[model samples]
Target chain A: MSFLFARDGHLLELGIDGLLAEELSAAERAELDQHLSTCAACQARVDEARALMAQPLPALASHTAETEEIKPPDLEQEWSAANNNRLWVATGVLLAVAAALLVVVLPSGSQPEAFTARGGELSLEVYRQTAGASQLLLDGDGAAPGDTLGFRVRLSEELHFALVGADSNDAVYAIWPPQGGSAAMGPMQAPEQLAAAIQLDATPGIERILAVACDAPFQLSDEQVLSISEAGDAPQVQEGCAQELVRLDKARP
Target chain B: MPPTLDIDQLYRRYGPLVLRRIRGFFRDPAEAEDVLQEVFVRVMESSDSFRGAARPSTWLYSVTTRHCLNRLRDAKRRRELLDEHGTAMGWGASAESAQQPAQLLIKQVWRELDPELLEMAVYYEVDGMSHGQIAELTGVSRRTVGNRLAQLAERAKDIGGGAR
Candidate 1:
C-alpha cells in the first residue's frame, strides 16, 4: 500500500484533524503524494506535529502523601491459630509483643531479664486430603539462630519417614523408627485422619513446625515430646507446648 | 562544616523538574504538589546518608521512582477495595520548566510516561547513565530496562506521530 507523505501540507491538515481514516479517496491520496515532493518545510512541520501527537493522553493526577500507608499488625499481638480444624487461641497481645521482640531484634547487653532468651512454641496438626497421605502445616511465632525444628512423616506400618532438613533445599533426610518398636509407621489413607507427632526437634535457626496427617483428630498438651524417625536415620525429637486438639474435614473433590 | 548539602537548596534547584515530572502522572495539580512535597520531606530525612553517591539528581530520580511505585501500588489496592478502575490524571498546563524551551519540552514530554519508563528514559537520556547503573539502582535486569525504554520511545512516537 502507498503511504501518505506526512510532509504533504494537504495530508498534514487531514492528519491533524484525525481525518486520515483507513482508506483515502484517490484525489486526496494523489494530493498528499504530490505535495510532499515540493515541501521540505512541510516535512519538518509534519515531524514536529507527529512528535507532539504521541504525547500520552492526560491522566488524573495522583497524590502520594494523601494515601494511607498500610502497616503490618502490631508486633506484639498473638495470631489466633485457626485452619483446617479446631481453633487454638494462644497468648494475647502482650505476649505477642514479647514474642516479636524475642524473635526479631539483635540481643543487646541491656536486654531485660524477661527478654533474655527467645523460644519457639511448637504445635502439630493433622489434615485429611482426599488423595494424599498427609500434609504438614507449619507456623511459628518467632525464630532465632541455633534453633532447629523438623516434621517426621511415617509412610508405612514399619514407621518409615521421608524427612526434610531445615535451610537446605532438596535434601530429604529420611529416617525409620527403630525396628519392632511400640509405634509403627503407617500409610496415611483416609480423609479426616490424624497425623501422629512423628518428631519435633529444635536446632539453631529453625522456626515452628505443624504436621497434619491425612485423616484423624489430634490433641495438644503440655506433657509430651513426639519422636519421628526415618529409615537409617537417628530419631529426631521436639519439645514445647503439646498438640492442641484439632479436626480435619475433607474439602470437596 | 563540610560544605553543607542543604536539601532545601537542592529542592530549590530541582523542585520544578520533579514537580513537572510528577505532574505528568496525575491529572490534578494539587496531587502533583502533594507528591512533590512528600519527595522533599523524604530527601531531607535521608540526606544525611547520601555521602556523595551518584549525582544528586540521579539519586533523586531513583528515590522519586520508588516513591511513585509505592503510591501506585497503594492506589491499586484502594481501587480494588472500592471496585473502581484506578486513574492517574495528568496536569501542569501553565507551569514552564526553568530549562531552555527545547529542553523543557523534552522534559515535559518525559512526564507523560509511566513512571517506570520515564525513569529509564531519564536515567539513559538525561542523567547519561549506562543501563547497568540503572539496573543496579532499580533492581531490574539491564535488558528489561532497555526494553522499557524502547517501548516508551515507540509510544512517544505514536503520540507525536501525527503531531508534525
Candidate 2:
C-alpha cells in the first residue's frame, strides 16, 4: 500500500485498504474520489491491490471429494507448548537428550581435554574431565586417559540425532540415550547438556563419537556410520546418516 | 420454523474464497485446507457467535482471516513440537502453486518482519484491508495502523519486491 498527494497536496493513502477502511465522512470520500477520478497512477495501484485480493487458489479435488478431511491439530501438543516444556520428543529435544549422556573414562589430569567439530549446521564438543569435576565439557580441550568426558551438543530444531561411537575393534556403542530401548529423558535442556565417562580401559585408537542428525529416527546401522575423527585410519562411513564427528585422542600403548 | 443451517453447505459455497485467502499465506495445500476446515468448524461449533457477530458471510470472513493468522503462527513451531506431542496437523497434497506472489514475497522476508508490522501488513496489503478497517478489525487506533503501514511501505522499498 502507498500514499499519494491529491491536487490540494493533502496526503492520500491509496488502495481499497486505505481508502475504504478509513471510515471517511461524506466530504472526505468525495474529496478522495474526486482526486482518484483523474489520478491514473493511484487508480492503477488500487486496481492491482484489489485484483490480487481477489486472487483464487486453483481448484484441487481428486474426483470431487467432499471437503477433504483436515486432521485436527494435535491439541495435546499445543497444550504442551503453551504449558509444559517437559516433552523431549521434538528432534531437538531428542537430539539434545540423546547427545547429553556420553561418558568416556579416559585418563584425567589437572586439565581434561576437549575437541570440537562442526558439521553442516551441527556443532558439538567432546571434553574430558576428572570424575565429578565442575569444568564445562564444551571448552574444546581434549581429554586424557582415565578421565570422565561429557558432551555439550547444540542442534538445530526439527532434527533427531543419535550419538554413536566405534573403537579400533569396530565394536559400536550408543554413548548417549544408552541402548536397550530405555525410557525417554525427562524435561531437559533443548540442546542437551550431556556428560558421560569414556572408559579408561577401552581400546583406544581415535575413538570417535559420531553424532548423526536425521529428519526422522531410523535404526543406526553399523555400516551407515562413517569415521568421525580428526585422525588417520578413520573408518569410512558407506551408506547413510548425516553426522557431526568428535574425535578424542587416547594415550598410545 | 426457520430452516436449520447446514455447516457443510456453507463450506461448499464460501470455502473456495476462504481457501484462496488462506492459501495466500501458505505454500502447502494441506495447510490451507486445514485452515479452511478449521474456519468452518469454528463457525459450526460457535454458531451462536457466528449468528451474533454479523451476517454469516462477514463473520466467516473475519473468522477465516483470524484462523489463518493464528495457524500460521502455530505452523512455524509445529516442526519442533508436534511429533512428540501427538499426531501433527495432518496435511494433504496441495493443488495450489506454492509460489503465489505474496507467498514468494513472504518467503523471501517473513523472518525480517517484526510481529506487529507483519500482522498489520499481512492484513492490509496481503489481505487487502484498509487502515481504518484494520483498526476496527484489530481494535487499534487508526493512527497506529498508518504508522505500521508506513513502516511496512518503507521496509518494502528497502527490501525491494513487495506489495507496492
Candidate 3:
C-alpha cells in the first residue's frame, strides 16, 4: 500500500517536509531532490507550501481597530412600541477622519454622532414576514420559530459588507452572501432589501447578527466570532469600516 | 509543565507543514485552504487542550489529518473527490496502478471505515508511519495501532472485492 505519487517508497509530503525543515539526511535529501526535479506535481506542491510559509502575518491594526461594546438590547420592549411601526434600525458610521483618530485614540470616542461632520453611514434593517406582510423587528426583539426574517441594508457610500450570525449554541454561520465572501454594494440613500431571507429554526435562544461594512472585502472567521462571543464584545473593524450588532431572542411559540 | 507556544508563532512555524498534509488529502486547493483555516480556528478555540501535548507538530498533524478525513467522509464531498481524482488512481494505467493500490483502496472504502480506523489508514498508508509512530501520536499501544490498520486493510479488501 503506497501513495499515488510515491517514488521508491518515499512519500512526497514527508520528503517535502524533511527537505524544508533540513531534517533529511544527505542521502535522503539527494534522493528527494532528484525525484522532485522529475515530478511536476510534487514540485508544485513544494512551491505552494514554501510560498505559504513565507507569507507574513496580517498587521494587528487590521484586526484591532474599532470593536463596539456589546450592549444588551432591551428584550422586554416590543418592536412597535420601540420604533413606532416595527422598524428596527441599527446604524454604523465610519469616517476616514475618525479612523485616523482611532490610530491614536481609543475606540470609545469614535461614535457615529461624534464623527457626523463627514463620513459614510451603514445601517441594517431587519423585517419579519407574516401573512404576506412584512414587519420590521427591533434589536433584542422576540422572534419565534418558523418566522421568516428579511434584511434591508442602507449604505451612504459604496463598500463591501458581510452579514454573520452567532447563535446561543455558539454556532457561527454566514447570513448574507450565503457562502462566505463579502458582497459589494453601491451607495443607496434608501434602504434596499436583500434577496435572501432567513427562516428561523426551532433552536431557541439569542441569535446575534453582526453586519460589517468595510472599504475592502473582508471575512470574519468563526474563531473571531467565537472569541468576540466569549468576550461578550462586538467585532472590531478597522478604519473606514463600520460594524453593527443586532441580537434577536428566539423562543418556542 | 509542558511548554506553551503562542498561536501566532505556531502558525508561522508549522502552518506550511499542516497545509501540505491537508493538500495531500483534499484535491481542491480552495477546500484545503478552508480546512486549514478551520484547523487553526479549532486550535485557537481549544488552546488549553494543546498545552500538555508532547510535541506541537504531532498534535497539529493529528488534528489536520482528522479534520481532512472527516471532511472527506461527507457523502457529497466524497463523490466529488472521487470524480476529481478517479483518473489519477489505480484504474488509470498499469504504471499508476502499481503505485496507487492504497489510494484506490482508500477511495473505495474510506466511507465505510470509522474515524479511528480511517486515521490509522492515513497514518500507515499515506504518511508511511509505522505502528509505533502512530501509537505514540495517538496515545495508543503499538499492538492496537497494528490491529486497527489490519482491520482497515481487511475492510478495504472486502469492499474492493465486492466492487469487482
Candidate 4:
C-alpha cells in the first residue's frame, strides 16, 4: 500500500540518501516528482545536488592516446628485478652469517689475503730448497704422483732469485736431455712470475715434486710461499706410455 | 536508427564534462588521463557495436564512468594500507574534497564509514548514473542502491550541519 506522509516529514528520509539519480520505481518516482513540484524544500535539495555536480574540475593535460605507447610494464623486467632483490637479500644474509662466524672462530690477527701490511714487514715464513733434492714438499701434505696442485709466493723486496722448497725422503725426479757444459744445473728464477715447474718421473706411488723459486736465497716479505691442494686428477698432456702406443698405432695406419 | 557517432567528434563536444566526471573519482592527473584514454580506446574498439543503444554522449558517459569507478574501487583498496599506516593520505589534493555533498560526507567519514554506502553515493551523484547502472555495478537491487544513496545523503547532511 502506498502511504503518503506529511510534506515536511517525507523529505527527512529522502535527505538521508540524497535522492537517487536513476532507476526509480513508478510509485517512488511519481512521489518524488510530485514532492518536487509542490514542496520547495525537496526542489532546493535536488538543485543543490545538481549545482555541486556542476562545479568545474581541473583540465586534463592534452595528449593524444592514439600515438602514445601506453603499454604495461615489462613482465621480464619485473621478474628480473624481483630475482635481483632476492639475490641481494640472500647475499646480505650470507655475508652477515659469515661475518658472525669470523668474529667467533677466526683469529683476531688474521687479515685478508689481499692485505699488504705496512711498516717493518718481515719474512715470517720461508720454504728452502737445495738444487739436488729428490723431492720437495710444497705443502703440509706432499704431492702424490697423480695429484694436482697450485702455488703462490710473495716477496717483501724484489729479488733476482730465491730457493723455495727442499728435497725430501719421498720425492720424484725427472731427467732431461743431457745439459750442455755451459747450461746451469738449476732453473732460472723469475720473481715476476712468482713460480717454477719441474715434472716428476711418471712412476707408481711416487711423490710429484715442484721446484719453485730456485736460483738463490733472496730476502722478501712475510708472504714467502703459499701452496694449496685442489681435488682433481693430474693432467696428462705430454708423451707417456699410453700416448706412445696410440701414436704407434696411428703411424701404422 | 541512431546514427553512429564519430567518437573523436563526440570527445571534442562533450569530453570536458566526461573528464570532469572521472576527475571526481580519481584524484591523480595521470590516473584521470589513463581513464580518459581507456574510454576512447573502448569506444574506438567497439565503434561497430554501439548500434544506437543510447545517445552517443550518454553511452560515452556511462562507459567512461564505469571505467573510472572500477579504477577508484581498486585504488581504494590499495590506499587502505597507506591510509592506516599513515603513509599516503589523499591523491595529491583532488581526492580531498568531494564534488558533491554526499561525496564530501565520504571524504570526511571514509575512515569509519561503510564502503558500500560510500560507493552508492559515488555511483549516484558523482557519476550521474542510473539506479540500474549502480545495481548492475554493485550486484544489488536498484531499490537497494537507491535506498542506500538516500540513506547516505541524509546522514551526510546531518553530519555536514553538525560540522558547520
Output the number of the DockQ-best candidate.
3
Model 2 spans with C-alpha error above 4 angstroms: A1-253, B1-6, B26-31, B45-48, B74-106, B112-116, B157-164
lDDT string for model 1 (A1-253, tens) is 1123221113322222221221445775566556656665545545544553444322211112112111111212211121211111111111110121111111101000000011121122221111212122212223322221112222212221221121111112211111211222243211111211222212212212222222222232212112211111122222221222111111100
Reference-based TM-score, model 3: 0.47
Q: What is the TM-score of chain B alone in each candidate?
A: 0.52, 0.58, 0.82, 0.52
Q: Which pairs clash inside model 3?
A: A67-A236
Model 2 agreement with the true structure over B48-164: per-residue lDDT tens digits: 545554334444555665555444433223333333323222111011111144444544454455444556655554444567656755457999889877776676677674554
What local lDDT does model 1 show for residue A33? Answer: 51
lDDT (C-alpha, whole model) for all candidates: 0.32, 0.44, 0.55, 0.33
Most lDDT-accurate candidate: 3
Residue A249 of model 4: what lDDT?
7
Model 2 Cα lDDT, one tens digit per residue, A1-253: 1232321333232223334334344665676678668766556655654554455533433112222322221222221121111111111223221233344433222233324445544545554444222222322223344555555455544456566665433456666555511122322111234444455333333444676555555556665444322232224333333456654433221
TM-score of 4: 0.30
Most accurate candidate by TM-score: 3
Question: Candidate 3 at A116: error in angstroms?
Answer: 38
Single out the weakest 10-residue window by summed lDDT for candidate 1 chain A: A108-117
The C-alpha local distance difference test score for the whole of candidate 1 amounts to 0.32
What DockQ class does candidate 4 belong to? incorrect
On DockQ, the stronger of 1 and 4 is 1
RMSD for each of the candidates: 22.2, 21.1, 18.1, 32.0
